[model samples]
Target: MNIDKNSVVTLHYEMYDANNQLIDKTEEPIAYLHGGYDGIFPLVEEALQGKAKGDVVEVTLTPDDAFGEQDPEMIRIEPLDVFPVEVEVGMMFEADDPETGDVIIYRITDVADGKAVVDGNHPLAGMRLRFKATVDDVRAATQEELAHGHVHGEHGHHH
Candidate 1:
């Protein structure tokens, strides 16, 4: 079946940075609701439209289309007391951007005496991306899945 609005799509993908260095790859197939459900990248969704099982797609995404450009303001050094003692590099937490009041995830980049460096920009931000995917399955989305704006079952959310 063709991937369309309300369709659940299963696919395996590998992502590479602009320099052609592999950054991420799906170990197992992942499923996402097709259409404008925000379940996947808009560009990727557009590329997959009308595709069916076994179809392959390769697309390049600019920083703006993927994770957005990195913002220097998103990096800050906070007082060490603000984070748990166990905090270490790579630990992440949700925080509100003090300037924009928007919620963002902050990853600990450094921990030092009385200070901790956190960055709100996504790790892949500012880099162009290339995606190569092979469609594995396409099926009509369940009513529950549509209502939740996501896919269900294997490679999907549970609970």
Candidate 2:
């Protein structure tokens, strides 16, 4: 079946960096609701439009199209006391942002000089991404899946 609105689209894909270095590859096919459910990247979903099983697609995404440009303002250095005990690099924590009234996840990037350096930007932000995928399947989404705005069951989310 061809990918269409409310369809469950599955793809076996690989991601690469601008330098041609392999970044990530799917070991199992990843499935997402097609036609603007926001489950997949806009650029990729656009490319997959009307695609059928066994079809191949290749696309490149800029910072804006992908994770977005890195925001330096999201970085903050706070006193060690602000964090939980035994803080270490690569740990993630959620902190309330007063400016936006939103909880932002911060990753501990450094711990030094009685301070913790945290960054809120996604790790892949500011990097160009290249993707290649083979369409594996496309089937009409069930009413429940449509209502939930995502795919459900078999390689997807469950109740």
Best by lDDT: 1
Cα-based TM-score, every candidate:
0.89, 0.93
Clashes by residue pair, model 2: none
What is candidate 1's local distance difference test score?
0.92
Q: Tell me the tens digit of each residue's lDDT in model 1 across 93-147.
A: 9977678889999999998987889999999999999999899999999999989
Candidate 2 residue lDDT tens string, 5-83: 8899988999899998999999999999998989888999999999899999999999999899999999999999976
Model 2 regions more than 4 Å off: none
Write down the TM-score for model 1.
0.89
Sliding window of 10 residues with minimal summed lDDT for model 2? 78-87
